[model samples]
Target: MKQLIILTLASLFFTASAAADEALTAEVLKEKSLAMCESKASVLPEGEKAEALAVCQCVAENTNYELILEAKKSGDDSVAKQHMEETLKTCKAEDASIGS
Candidate 1:
């Protein structure tokens, strides 16, 4: 009986973990990315908001979230984070709407 209870508890714990992972989908990540970008861009002039949003959207769409997820699961985001920054740079360069 004790063994069965342990097994049930373990099962529930893993199930909950799986559900949490499922909830962190790409859309959720994108929204989070956009929110962070919005907060940072808030300091910019009001006229640049649209360009900032465009850059944010480009980063969110171009990023390889699988790399981010792997980093999350493995607890090492250095490289994945670098990739995200690279994406940001690329997006900013491509937009050419802000910064003069």
Candidate 2:
């Protein structure tokens, strides 16, 4: 039937659109993460500046992009905040060990 064919095509179009949106969201998250790291790193003290930058980079590189996207989609920040806190804690611990 023509209606069935039209429905199938529409479904495919929606699926493709969703995939593209997900990819765009991922790219946006990556850019945001890097920008956040750069801004945070710029304000660190000279003595621990490198370590601080390293921590930020570590956090950015290790964060779960999918979790961030899910949180954003649901309008809930808890997942994203939890990820950030965990990343910071882990990175800080690593940085402390480096200075030891």
Candidate 3:
């Protein structure tokens, strides 16, 4: 009975730890995406920097972190590049509509 109790407690502790790790992983992925966006936005001309940053921010906000992680693990950047292109296209359309 004592051994059963100890095992139960150990299982609970491990389950909680795993959950915390998963949450941490998600947060880290989000930070990485934002950093990537910031890096991409930094190359824009001074006049376009703000709009570019906004586009990058949108990309970071809309990106699928899980797909990004999978692509990273597989050493495939296509998914990430696709996301960037889509974000830029959308932002450009918005800018055009605004007469910018």
Candidate 4:
């Protein structure tokens, strides 16, 4: 039936869309990690800075932190803004010095 055909097509479309989302999410996370590392690497003091940089690197590598990654990659300004707020909160909570 036409209805059955339409449903199958719809399912395929949604599945493909989800896969694309996952791929984009992964790409965004990778970019965010690299950026975080680079940013920390730039400002951290020589010896003490190494510890901060390591923390950032650990956060970049260890956490899911996927939502911000998605928002940033999608170029959604509102989402990006919200994500930034959340990220700042996380930094403050996890490492107070991060807020500085």
Candidate 5:
């Protein structure tokens, strides 16, 4: 029930991403990233731990967010890190869920 509520609150913050760029805001991208990262875990009301949320936030802030989404869609997971290597490293150092 708690996980459901957390997911529900996350849903209220952002819808699923479509292929369209305009529909994918930074906030939306962060949520999508969080969902993918923690599909098997529970999150806080803020959607993630501070470190993980910070990582996702940094990833979302990148101009190439669509590229990461595109790469993931294409099964080219390597490309997802193209623009986020630094953020990943930094966040991982902090033990962020998405970073791990």
Candidate 6:
């Protein structure tokens, strides 16, 4: 009976750990991407308002806190800027992808 209980507890702990890991990964992705997008939007020209808005939308959709922290640490401004631009383009290509 004691052995069975120990095995069950071990299985439960492992299952919970897996779920937490998945959730953390998703959160990280969203945060990092959003920070980059926000920065990009702030720098866009007035004539490109629509595209800038799309960048913000994509960041909201795709960002996570963990990823943003990583990006900040790397100090890769150009890469982040390019990423935001591509995200804006992708949002425009998928109708109804932004401004919802």
- Model 6 lDDT per residue over 6-96, tens place: 2322322233234344543545455544454555555556666455545455445743333333443465544444544454445545635
lDDT of 4 by residue, 31-89 (tens): 55546466546654565555455445444444444554455457554664454445434
Which parts of model 3 are misplaced by more than 4 Å?
1-26, 32-46
Judge candidate 1 at residue 98 and give its lDDT: 52
| Candidate ranking (TM-score, best to worst) | 2, 1, 3, 4, 6, 5
| lDDT of each residue in 26-53, candidate 3, tens digit only | 4565565566556655665677666655
What's the lDDT for all of these models? 0.57, 0.57, 0.51, 0.46, 0.47, 0.44
**Number of the top-ranking candidate, with TM-score as the measure:** 2
| Every model's TM-score | 0.59, 0.62, 0.47, 0.40, 0.35, 0.36
lDDT at position 13, candidate 4: 29
Model 1 residue 59 CA deviation (Å) reads 1.0
Clash pairs (backbone) in predicted model 4: none
Error of 3 at 8 (Å): 47
Displacement of residue 10 (Cα, Å) in model 6 is 41
In TM-score terms, candidate 6 sits at 0.36
The stretch of ten residues in a row with the least summed lDDT in candidate 1 is 1-10
Segments of candidate 5 deviating more than 4 angstroms: 1-22, 41-80, 96-100
Model 4 misplacement above 4 A: 1-28, 31-43, 58-66, 69-75, 97-100
Candidate 6: C-alpha lDDT: 0.44
Q: Write the number of the candidate with greater lDDT, choosing between 1 and 6.
A: 1
Pairs with backbone N, CA or C atoms under 3 Å apart (clashes), candidate 1: none
Query: What's the TM for model 5?
Result: 0.35
